[model samples]
Target chain A: MRLWLPPVLLAVLLCGLSAGMPALEPLFHWVQPDKQQVIYERESFLFLLQNHLLLVLISAAVGTLVAVAGGIFATRPSGRDFLPLVSQVASIGQTFPPVAVLALAVPVLGFGEAPILVALMLYGLLPILRNTLAGLEGISPAVKEAARGMGMSPLQVLVRAELPLAGRVILAGIRTSVTINIATAAIGSTIGARTLGDPVIAGLVNGNTAYVLQGAILIGLLALATDSLFEALERTWDRRFSPQVAV
Target chain B: MSVSRSESSQLMPNRVIPALGLLALALVWLLDVGTIQPNRIVPGTGHGLVSAVGWGGAALVTSTLAGSILLAFLNLRGRYLIQLALLGLSLALLPLLLDVFASRHLPEDSPFARSSIGAGFWCLLFFLFLMLIETLGRLGSRRGLELLLVVVIGGSWLIFLQSEGLESLSLVREFNARPAKFEQAFWTHLALAFGAVAISAVLAFGLALKMMRSPGWQRPILGLVSFLQTIPSLAVFGLLIAPLSALVAAFPVLETLGIRGIGWTPALLALVAYSLLPMVRNTFVALTEVPENLADAGRGMGMNERQLFFKLKLPLALPVIIEGVRITTIQAIGLTAVAALIGAGGFGSFIFQGLGQAAMDLVLLGALPTIALALLADAVFTMLAASLKPTPATA
Candidate 1:
């Protein structure tokens, strides 16, 4: 019998069967209806989870568009000189601390979700940008020239000729951005953006180790799950679309 | 050479137009800030003709820039717009540096305190104008200019944070400030972590060199390092605590040798351990790709293995090794921020402080510096890697 360790464990983590989401609220809260004292509800937990996921998806989608376009730009002759510039810019995005990025952008964008989205997008850009550049550069010039000589449009060459060849490397970029985004999304929750980090942050403050564990494990599991899933998708994509790609 | 100079000179006017455009925009912001009534707290102002001018000017500048960028894309214009932007930014920062960082350090109510805005504009504008001129000037290398800009930006901030920086400068001050908890707290944790990575870099370099020469040892060691990286950084820290604690118990000397704890020591050691795989693997790859025929030629010349490793392989491998270092340093910076989770502190002092207080501003104070540190480290690495490559003149 074949045993699948990663899938089995990942499933358990996601199901919150073996490990559960963490507690976020203080031990007591004043109820909205009767002013009676109570703990925070399950509703806040759900809100955090939903917002966290939304931030991740939006950031990653923005990242993909920018990276792919950047990749294409990097492949052009004049843009070739911009590799260092683009890399440096992305690193700045990486370097401009997320909190600082929030501070810097706050005057421009204001509080809450917008700043968080900006942070994740900035952080998410580098790997995707770098990978896109690297992937496109790695494509054989001869193959590209051949595509052009055959009367194929530039778009056609990029889509059918160059991208297909660079799929694996591009996928690697996607993987890096996705994983980084997962960790960074937690930082957003700190700014009232509601994320699984609510529990973790709450737990740490109150010295409630259990609450911390609940948040930490779920977030960790989330990262691991994305990592594994993307990795699988990468492998599958490579096998199907570019059969000749070296594993 | 003569032809190249002529070609570059032809590129001069391409630089000038955009630079002028940026200056014009800066003038507009200046007018806006000067003439507009201030809300003080809100940037870009809340109302009045100045506010209108402030935003209007900003929109116009953005469009001009976008236009310039579009021209570059279309190969019609603005190829030099970017150069001008960096130029303006760098120049503006120099004076702004005086204002932002130096202001509060002065007597609290001094009019000179707000004069930082003047300093800000002067320095920043100078840098911008200089850069635009430089592209036309080719007066200095772009890389040098970029470094100067970063230094101007970061150095000014450092000057601003001297109080905090000086406080954390010494282990003696740090330890004496808290006797019993010396080994467990934030400052010690950061120092240990910083030390761990530095030590690990040296150790990993040696280990990598050894494994590169020996097939039997390389595979297992690489596997171990890769596996180590896969462990959640926190989990690794957790796993390490028990082993470290056990080792300290079994061999008491290890404790006095400066081994210990759920604190900085273990956290740092674990981070270093995580760091090694990338450095070692990168070093190995760099060394191995030195084209075996070069080593064969060295052997034919009767050079000893040691000489060949250093004189040829190491120099050839320097770029990749430095690239690895770049990655390691950034990773270390990020991970170091997490060191706060284990009670070890760098700038994570601000991060946790912000979290506990739920004050986002406080967290930015900590995190911004960490990000700056990471970026600065990346810049340093990039420069090192770039310098290692065979220069065009040499080639």
Candidate 2:
């Protein structure tokens, strides 16, 4: 199977379902025969999908940048003293569940998109930070020495040698971070951020099975599509870079 | 050369403690240490460090932080021990810091008046703990020592909270109102999270064993579990409700047994489904990765396949399997909170209820315990895995 095929297929299906959801009213009517309104109409599916994707994307971008920078600094000579604490914090912080983090944020930051975004960014950064630290530290000393022997400065070695070697691991970290943020952002609707979870929360609040099914199907497809995209990206990175490492 | 240089640098003044100290000092003076509320719903007036705890408290806080920084810079022999002692004392005494604020500022006129911790106190506590953790790491402390420190600090805080001095604190006040309900929520949360973990562990072990015996079953099984995992928890819970309700409708006897479309039934099913990926993956990897030579040695010693399987592979696999349990338990505890939306009783019910009521304190009452539980699970499982691992010499 082609690497890109699955994600593309999933994406198309997700889009089609979101766009054509109202067209399937008869089917939903069968599912919820007692209900007068079988379909959720508080917010359009496409709009919620966009809002959800935007939240996840923005958080993933900011989290990747901040976590990567912090990871880099901790591994550097000047910041080495902070390494133990930083790495410890990264690992320990993850033990606090994302939902708990979201709940805690509302008290400090107040409810709405801001608190959820802050929570998502903070919580989502952990796995990425951990991966970044591990990737950078796992590089062989001999490899660094070789880079230095070839007249690379510390910065040059870092930019050229360290980062390239660590990039795959860092990407994997971002994948994990994005995967988590997607789910958390869906739950963010409860805290008042418009997301795909809105319909499901609405459905659950009122006895509407059709609404629940719509949201669940979309969220599931989005996750699948995003995950496959990452898989394809990782495969491409492996193909391009594994040859160099092997030599 | 680099190794010696790195070693020598270890003797240099520690940066982490001082950095944390300076930041905590700034935050304590800069932000409000506590707030005074008229009642549960009313927003409170925040009091800064000096105003809230008075000059004596402020002076004491400043000196302690400054002393920590000084200690970090002193380069004395066994400074980590000194730092650890100082930090641990400060952390254990932290609740009393709030007690001081509560006593100083709480209105005597209104019984409804309550005190809540402000951002500054949280910052101070957080930094102190961070500094303590850094100190512990620097000391290369044993797990036993770390656990003892936690127990000591945790015990002190528990004792202090139970005392009358902190009764006006919002979190405690929230707890006092619904003590029975709180207990029920605690038990319900534990039951759902652990119940799912227990069930999934058994199912995963069977699945993993099957995968071990037959390669063909591996991909599909893993694929199915991973697919389940990738879906959001809310989506899974939502999806489970329809089918479950239909089943209950179809079979009226199911309702008597407490199997319903919504509630713990769907919650547990969703949790178990979500847990399979980690549990199965870990068990499979652990069993497969057991050294072959050890198995041959067991066979040579006249052990039968069953004996060798249990004695060799299972023993070696136990730690990794426990690690999976660690991961699964943490995930389940969190998801169980989400399950409250489906009428499943847990800490999450408190969270969503609080969220609905727009009660920040109530939210804190819910969220804090959930976090504590997850952290506790993490620590317990980590220790279990560590203890179960074969030491280097034995391996």
Cα lDDT of model 2 by residue, A99-212, tens digit:
999999898898899999999999999999999999999999999999999999999999999999999999999999999999999999999999999999999998898999
**What is candidate 2's TM-score against the reference?**
0.98
Q: What is the interface RMSD of each candidate, in Å?
A: 6.2, 0.7
lDDT, model 1: 0.59
Q: Which digits, one per residue and each the tens of the lDDT, describe model 2 over residues B81-167?
A: 788999999999999988988898888989999999999999999999899999988877478779779999999999999998999
Candidate 1 runs further than 4 Å off: A1-9, A16-54, A73-87, A95-113, A241-247, B1-193, B206-210, B213-224, B227-263, B355-361, B386-395
Fraction of native contacts, model 2 = 0.82
Candidate 2 chain B, which ten residues in sequence have the lowest lDDT sum? B1-10
lDDT of 1 at B226: 68
Provide the lDDT at B101 for model 2. Answer: 86
TM-score of the second chain, cand. 2 = 0.96
What docking grade does candidate 1 earn?
incorrect
